[model samples]
Target: MIVDHRIYTCHPGKLAAFVKLYEEAAWPLQQKYLKNCLGWFTTTEGELNTVVHLWGYDSLADRDAKRGAMAADPAWGEYLAKSASMGLLQKQENRICKPAPHYEAYTKAKG
Candidate 1:
């Protein structure tokens, strides 16, 4: 599986608002278009106002298609606008990753 990780640094004091909008508005829209969307979460420790979410895809093509589908959805567009209006995030970073051979071992050890 492929994992698309998005790291968002929100403006100070806006983390709660961002999370509310993400859960109430954006996540539902994402659910409609992205069947492989694993989940969305935020960092509570090291980076205080950082959001990290992951989407799982069968392949690169599947990811592209799902994103396109989401973009085309009217509800998703509305949700995006609403979510964006909630707060201005300071920085955004996106990374696409595949599980490495040692990933399982690392996760097991961490667990």
Candidate 2:
């Protein structure tokens, strides 16, 4: 399995707006395409105004296909426009990861 993890840093004082936008606009649309949304979170310490989310995919091809579909959706476009207009985010980072050897078994078991 593959994990697509994202960290989004919001513009100062915009964290609530960013989170609200995703909750109200993006989450429902994303759910239509992404099968396994592991979790969504916001930081309470250390990095303020940061949000993190994780998506699980069967493979890189699966990830690409799902994301591509989402990108093509008009609702996704609307969400993008809303975010862009609000300028809620300062920056974002992405990471693709696989479970470690020892953790692979546990991951599979949980799945």
Candidate 3:
């Protein structure tokens, strides 16, 4: 499996607006296309206005195909435009990860 971790740093004091827009608009659309969202969170500690999301995919090809489809959707475009107009985001970063061999076993045991 592959995990995609996305971090968004919102403009100072704009995190709430960003989160609201995302929940009301983008989240639904993303749920339709990317079905394996692991978690969505916001930092309350070290990085104050940062939002983080994790998505799991069966493989890189799966992630690409799913994301490409989402990008082509007209509703997704509209959401992007609306979010951009808000000027809430300051920076964005994405990282793709692979689990260590023992990770699955560790999680199962923890569960």
Candidate 4:
């Protein structure tokens, strides 16, 4: 599986607002188009005003296709517009990862 991790550093004092907007507006849109999305979360400590999200997909192509669909969705467009107004993220970073051998076994057992 492919794991997409996004780290976002928001402007100071905007963490709560960012989380609220994500949960109430952005998350639903993400769920609609990116079915492989595993989870979304924010940092409570260590890195203040940081948001982290993970998406699991069968392959790189699958991830790309899902994101493409999301971009094409009108609801997603509206969600982005609303969420963007919430706050400015100082920096955004994305990483793609593959599970370790142990993780594969762990995931299968969970399933």
Candidate 5:
């Protein structure tokens, strides 16, 4: 399986608001399309205004299809517009990860 790990950096003191927006707007949409979110996180010490989200997919094709569905949704478009208008996001970094052999996530995918 592959993990779509995303890191979103928000403007100073805007992380809470950004998270709230996601909760109110995008969270349900994600559940409908990308059903396997491993975790959503906010840092305590190292990175101050960043949110990390991990999504698990069976393969790249799975990720692509799910993300395409989400991207096509009108609700998703609305959320993006809201976020852009608010200027809550500063940067976005994404990493597509493959679990190494013997890892729990990898093993589960095999099973």
Candidate 6:
């Protein structure tokens, strides 16, 4: 199993706007195409204005296929355009991870 972890740093006070837009537009689209979302989060103390979300996939190939389908959707394109136009985010980071031995069972169940 694999995990796609993403962090988005919003521009100063624009965190609320970014989160709102993402939930209203992008989240639905992602949920529709990528079925194994693990969770979504925001910082409470350190790294303020950053959002984090996790998605589980069966493998790298599965991740790529699901993401490709999402990218091909017109709604996803529109959401990207809207987010870019607002300039709500300052930076974004994504990481692909695999579970450690102890967590493998949990990942297998989730994935």
Off by over 4 Å in 5: 104-111
Lowest summed lDDT window (length 10), candidate 1:
79-88
- Which parts of model 4 are misplaced by more than 4 Å? 105-111
Candidate 6, residues 1-111, lDDT tens digits: the string is: 889999999999999999899999999989899989899998988999999999999999999999999999999999999999999999999999988987887756777
Q: Best TM-score goes to which candidate?
A: 2
Error of 2 at 59 (Å): 0.6
TM-score of each: 0.82, 0.93, 0.92, 0.83, 0.92, 0.92
The digit string of per-residue lDDT tens for model 3 on 1-111 reads 889999999999999999999999999989999999999999999988999999999899999999999999999999999999999999999999988879977866888
lDDT of 2 by residue, 1-111 (tens): 899999999988999989889999999988889969999999999999999999999999999999999999999999999999999999999999988988998867888
The 10-residue segment of model 6 with minimum total lDDT is 102-111
Q: Give a tens-digit lDDT track for model 4, residues 9-99.
A: 9899877877877788778878887876777778888988899999988999998998998899887787778767654677899999999
Give the lowest summed-lDDT range of ten residues in model 3.
Answer: 101-110
* Cand. 5 TM to true fold: 0.92
- lDDT by residue (tens digit), candidate 1, 28-47: 87888886667677787898
Model 4 has how many clashing residue pairs? 0
lDDT of each: 0.83, 0.94, 0.95, 0.84, 0.95, 0.93
Clash pairs, model 4 backbone: none
**Once model 4 is optimally superposed onto the true structure by TM-score, how far is the C-alpha of residue 3 displaced, in angstroms?**
0.3
For TM-score, candidate 5 versus 6, the one ahead is 5
Residue range 1-111, candidate 5, lDDT tens digits? 799999999999999999999999999999999999999999898989999999999999999999999999999999999999999999999999987777966677778
By summed lDDT, the worst window of 10 consecutive residues in model 4 runs over 82-91
